[model samples]
Structures are given as structure tokens and as C-alpha cells.
Target chain A: MHPVAVVNANGASPIVFVCEHASNNIPNMYHELGLNAADKISHAAYDPGALGVLRCLVNEFDAVGVYGTVSRLIYDCNRPPEAASAMPAKSEKIIVPANANITPAERDARTNAVYVPFTNTLADIIAQKGGQGIVITIHSFTPTYFDEPRHVEIGVIHDDDPTLASACVTELQGDGSFVCEINEPYSREDGVAHTLNLHGTKNGLQNAMIEVRNDLIATPDDEMKMGIYLAQQLRKTFKSLGIDLNEVSA
Target chain B: MHPVAVVNANGASPIVFVCEHASNNIPNMYHELGLNAADKISHAAYDPGALGVLRCLVNEFDAVGVYGTVSRLIYDCNRPPEAASAMPAKSEKIIVPANANITPAERDARTNAVYVPFTNTLADIIAQKGGQGIVITIHSFTPTYFDEPRHVEIGVIHDDDPTLASACVTELQGDGSFVCEINEPYSREDGVAHTLNLHGTKNGLQNAMIEVRNDLIATPDDEMKMGIYLAQQLRKTFKSLGIDLNEVSA
Candidate 1:
């Protein structure tokens, strides 16, 4: 499989959805990134249910998606190439031994092989949408972290330009069907908003990142239901923000 | 001036010279990277005499030249983006204060502004050359470092396929007028081979990087002399290697 998968290739949905930490399987060349089988499947390796939710979102909206086929531990597509954790030495308490001593050239090779393609594809898709390309990324987080319980059920993560996300949070709250907060559990300062900063703010496109609690999206039906809900909210949110999404003719 | 200066933009000479660490001035945006005036002019900032030699080579051969106009301390164009030294924190004993704590997005800003243009310009030039481009890079280093004196006058740097550099070394040695060595003071393992690997070897083009002693190229006359000598030797070397020089029309 390619390093990136572009769903609804011709989908002209102005609201482009991106799922960076979608896959947990490390590419064969990385040899599972020197992680044990359990670590490979852990939340540290990926956002377990994000891909399913993203696929549904893409299908429901006939929206475009750019996904990383390789695990984020090898190269986190969401992080900029210069981020220290782009290839992390440790995630939480688990050490990534393979990432500890990679040479600059080797690191660059991985960036070119993985990160570059995904970002380039995103840029191309946004460009294809012209002035209307709006970005919304989908991610999932575990209910507990480091043995501590987390409260927020859904997060509208954002960077400097928070119009899209603020609108998203407002709409999600109005629905009264979920617990929604702005930048909960993660923030741009925490290095979780690289995509929003680069693809959204830098490009002057309205964008937002959504983080769903992993437990709430544990099954396929749940993932799809949330995807459908988010898609409806996104359409309304875009309209509320004075942005019109020209749906692609599939 | 554009981020990259492509001298003789359409020159078709078989030998194409690129100068990566060609300038010492930081773009206006970087504000000299908080370096003192001395450090800005010192070897810690760039290959001082390399641009002179490159300009002369481009002029003499009527060949194409791609250059990085920003200080290496800001972004070393020769390095791959993932390189730790791409935005080096230190060079030798002097630490670069401005680079010590840059965010990934800030680092990528420099990469986007400085590094990308040079590489893209080189790629475009090579593509325009239409299958007859060969890569040759120009750089200069201090004759002494860390209280250790270096004896080599010229270093011919090469990547995996050393055909071009190996030939250049043989011709330089045959002249009996210069001291030349293969991979002296630097090698592929030193992370200096990224450009050669990407632009030369990966493109199936013959390529070499030449490093001259900084003292030898301290003046305009000195730079031009070395350039003329190298240009003449380059023509002979290309002929010896059975590579024809297709002179571009003025």
C-alpha cells in the first residue's frame, strides 16, 4: 500500500477531513519500530478508532481524506518534520528504541517516505478546492491516561485561527448530545495542532481538529454514527461561518 | 533576489555546479539569528568563499548554478530537512543561540523559506537540461579546526556512485599542480551526501562535491583562479569520463 491513502479522490467537498494517526501497523521496513506486539496496538502507536470514524466521515460527506498508512511511531504525519516528537524517543513511558539514535539522513529518509507525501497530498487537495478548502481533522484519545481519568468526551482542537473550531464547538454544544470542549486534553502549544497551523492558518483556510474519546467510539456502528453526526454539524458549522462547501460530484 | 539564484538559468554545460552554504547573511526575517557581528562573518555562519568560486564556475563554463542565499546557521541547504544540523544548534565550539529553542513550525518556516527554494530550483534546472545534467557542488572549509591543521588543498566529495568525483580526482592529480583527495575532511557518512544522493545518484546523474580550503580562496583573484582551474580540469575530466559537454547558446 502507498504511504498515503486519498479517499474520495475526486470528492470536491470543501470540508476536507484528515486523519493522521489512523494506522497502528508500522510499515514492514521499520520492523514494527522495535515495539512489542502490545505496544504496536496501544494508543501510543495510533488513535485506534480515528480511521473508522474518518472513513465514515469521508463516505457520508463524500469528503476527501489523507491518511498515513504507516504507524505514527515511525513518523507522525500530524507533526511538522522539525518537531522533536515527529519521530519520538518516547511516548508516555514507553521508549521507542529505534527512534533514539537515527542519523539525520535516516530521519530525512523517513520524512520523505512518509511525512512529505501526506502533507503534499493534503496541500494538493486543499489547492484543488480553491478558496473553499476547509480542513477538519479527526482523532481519538483514550479515556484514561497514565492511570488518570479524563472528563472531556469530545474536543474541538484549534490553533490561532479558532473560528472554524469555535463554531464547531458551539454547534456540538447546541446539539446537547455530547460533552464538547475547546482544546481539551490537547492544545496547539502542546504540539497537537501542526496540521491546523500549517494547512489551516498558514494557508488561510478555516480548519479545526476533533478528538473523540476512544471508548465512546469502540465499535464500527458507534464510529459511523459519530461520523454521521459530525458531518451534519460540519455542514451547519460551515454555513454558520459563511463558508460554502461545494460537494464533489462522485 | 529570489530565494535561489540560478546563474545561467538555461545553461546546458554537462557540469552543473551548486553551492549550498554559499552565503552568510540570514534572510531579513531571521535578524542575523542573534549572532554577534564576528560570528556572523566567521566560518560558523557559512562557506565564505564558496559563492565566489561558484559564480566564476558558472560564468566560465556558461553552466547552470544553484545557490542557497541564506546563512547555514539558519538552514543548511545541503542537509536533508530531517537532519539535526539542518538547523544546527552549534557549529564547532560556538553555539547558535537562536537555533537552540526553535519550534518545529518555526524550523519548517526556515526550511520553507530557505531550503526548499534552492532544491526546487536545482531540480527545475536539471529537468530543463533534458537528460544531460551532471551535478558538481562547490564548498570551502577552514584550513584548521579545533587546533588541528588540515593538509588537503582540495576535497572531492562523492556519494555511493563515485564515478564523477573519482575521475575529477584522477585528473586533478595528473595535473601535478594541486593536492586533491577523495572524501577528505568529509564523506557521505558525515551527512554531507544528501544532495548528491538525491540530485545525483537518485536521478542517475554523475555528481561530485568539491571542498576547497578557505584560506586559498580569500580574495577575488584567488576564487577566480581556482574556478578557472577547476573549469578547465572539469572539461578534461568530463571528456575522460566519456561525458560530453553540451554548451548552451548564449
Candidate 2:
């Protein structure tokens, strides 16, 4: 399968949506990367319901979406491939046997085959939108990780540029549907801001990554509602910011 | 005018060179961006001698080089657009009148006109190289800043991926020509690693930025010698790493 699936590649909207942990389908060749049935479906593999929400967001915003096609068990697309976490030997408390004892050459192979394609595709999408593109990455976290519960529902993540994320948090705060925080759940130091740094801030694109609590999007219907709500709030934010989405190309 | 100048864009080499602070030319339209002639040639405007060294690298390795056309004083190509440092109001105690009290729209305009094109062009070059692309950024720094003196002559900077920078440091040791350090002069936090983070590690490329003391490249002949030495050192490093520069399209 292709490393990434870009929805609405030719769409007119200037905004680009990214779902880095969108899939959990391990290839048959790797034999589920030595994981039990339950662990395979766990958050350690991928964000449970982010793809569904991202799809709804695409439809709502008429935007371009870049979605990873493989499970993080094979390769975490959000990570810099040279990092050991990119092909983690263990995530959370579970050991990934297939990731153990890998050679540098093998690691490079996975990066070339998977991570490179994903990056190249996303880069192309950003290039098409010119400099005025807005990047909105979608991600999710479990309500309880290892035993600790997270209460924040929306996390607006940023690196050096807080302007866009600040705008997002301001608009999200008044909605009152959920608790919102700047750099909560994960910050740039957590390595969660890698994608935004590469695609959004690097090119000076108005960018933000929204992290939703997995429990808040447990069901398909719930995910859809969250997506619609987010899209509307973002629309209002853009309108308030005076961004003409059609004027992205410079 | 084009925001970026690509030298040997399709050269059959794995490495792509970038000189982000190559120029000190502020377009005539902005009226030199409200800077005096002295400030225009100051370290705050551009990195002295970086372009000359970059040219030698491109020539020696037959590699692709992407050079920024405008001054960093206008819109720092290496910085994230939303970061205030990208359009600094002051650098090393020198005030930039044009950068001070600018509206968001004006800031965005400069980013759109200069930063976007440079980013898009580099992305296209990286895309063409597929997964085997290696990024090498060239820069120069002042001998003294804020009443402090620097003894190091060379700085090999990296973000997350240390493979390439480590290789260069190992090769440069005992060269008898310069003092070298990894992550010196500037690091990721200094915002100096912006290009490496965005274009290199983010895409899983073997990458590093080399910073030389400006005094070392004060003359045309000195620049040429420094450039030749750098090219030879880099060539030796690549050979030691078993990197086939022509085989970059993985």
C-alpha cells in the first residue's frame, strides 16, 4: 500500500489537515509485529479514532488531508526516523519483538520505504498551497495512559510560533464543550510538535495540532460531532483572523 | 525576482546544500528595510563568507545548492515565520527600524514574498532526491558577540539526527586547520537548527549545518581556501561514511 493517503489532493481549500497516527493496520509480512490481539488495538499502536474525525474534518472544511496508511508499530510517522522511538522496542508497557535487534540498514530501509514517502507527499501538498497554507494536524490520546487520567480535551500544540495556536485556543475556549490548553498533554519537547515544525512553522504557515481525548471520540458518531464542532470553531477563528481561505496562493 | 537561487539543482549528488544567510540585499521597494549602509553589511544582516564556502561545496561534490536571495534582516529563511526572530527588530544591540512595530499583514507579506518561495523550492529539490537526500546548510558567525569571544573555528550543528554531524566532526578532528565542535556556535534552541530540523531530520535525511568564524573568511582568497578545505573535508567524510552521492534516489 502507499505510505500515505491524501484526501482531496486537488481540493480548493487552502488549509491542509494531517492525521499522523491515522491507521493501525500492520502489514501481513511483519506478522502483527509480535503483538497480542488486545495490545494490537491499544493506543500504543495508533490513535484509536483519529482517522474518522479527520475525515469528517476534511468534509466539513473542504480541505486537503494527509493520512498515514500503516500502524505506528511498523514506523511512527510523526517521529524523526533516526530516533529510536521511531521504531520503538517497547511502547507503554508492551514489548515489540519485531523492533528488537534491528540493524541500521533495516531501520534505514523502513525510513526510505515509509517515512520518506509520507514526508514527500505532505511536502508536496504544502507546496501546492503556497506560503499561505494553514496546517491543522489531528491526533488523540487515551483518557487513561498507564493509569493516570488526562482531563484536557483539546490541546493546541505549537513550537516557536504561538500566534496560530493562541488563536485556536481562544476560539476553542469559548465553545465550553471541553477544556482547552496551550501545549497541554504534549509540547514540542515531547517530540509531538515535529510535524508542525516541519510543515507548518518551517514554511510560516498558520499551523496548529489539536489533540482530542480518545474517550471523547469513542464512537463514530461522537467523532463526527467533534469534527463538525472543531471545523465550525476553526471557521469562526479564521473569519475573526480575517484569513480568506481562497487567497492562499501567493 | 526569485526568492531562491538553485545552483546545480539537478546535480547527481545525494547532498543538497543550503546557505540561508547568503545575501544581504534588501529589495529596493522596502527602501533597504530602513537600515543604514553599515548595518546592511553587519552580521545582523547576513552571514559573511557562507555563500563562497557553499559554492565550493557545490562545485567539489557536484551537489545541489539552494541559496536565499534576500537578507535575514528582512525575513530569516531559517526561522519559523511566526517567530519574532524571523523578522528581528534588534540583533546584537542594533535596532532594525523596519522590523519594529510592523503590522501582522506586513510581516505576512514579507514571508509570502521571500520565505515561501525559498521553502517551496527546497522542498521540491528534496522531493526530487526521494529518500536518499542529505542536507548540508552553510552559515557564518561573528568572532565576538555581546562582549564575548569565541575560540572555536567550526561548528557542526544537528537537530535530532546526529549521524551526519558526528561523521563530519570525526573527519575534521586533527585537521590542523580549524577547531570544530558538534552543536556549537548555535544549536536547536538558538533557532540555528531550524533548517536542519525542518528539512533534514523531519524528512529523515542525513544532515548538518557548518558554521565558520567570519574572520576566517575575511578575504576573497581566504574564502576560496576555506571553501576548498571544507569541500575536501566533506568529501572525505562522505567517502568514510560509504555514501554514494549519485545513488540518492532510493
Which candidate number has the best lDDT? 2
Tell me the spans in candidate 2 whose CA falls farther than 4 Å from its real position.
B1-250
In angstroms, how far off is A217's CA in candidate 2?
A: 1.1
lDDT per residue for candidate 2 within B12-57, as digits (tens), equals 8878999998877677788977888677768888887787678768
Summed backbone clashes in each candidate are 1, 0
Error of 2 at B117 (Å): 49
Write model 1 residue lDDT over A63-116, tens digit each, in one string: 788877777888999998888899998988778889999899988998999989
Query: How much lDDT does candidate 1 score?
Result: 0.81
- The DockQ-derived docking category for candidate 2 is incorrect
List each candidate's DockQ score: 0.01, 0.01
Q: Once model 2 is optimally superposed onto the true structure by TM-score, how far is the C-alpha of residue B166 displaced, in angstroms? A: 65
- Model 1 chain B worst lDDT window (10 residues): B241-250
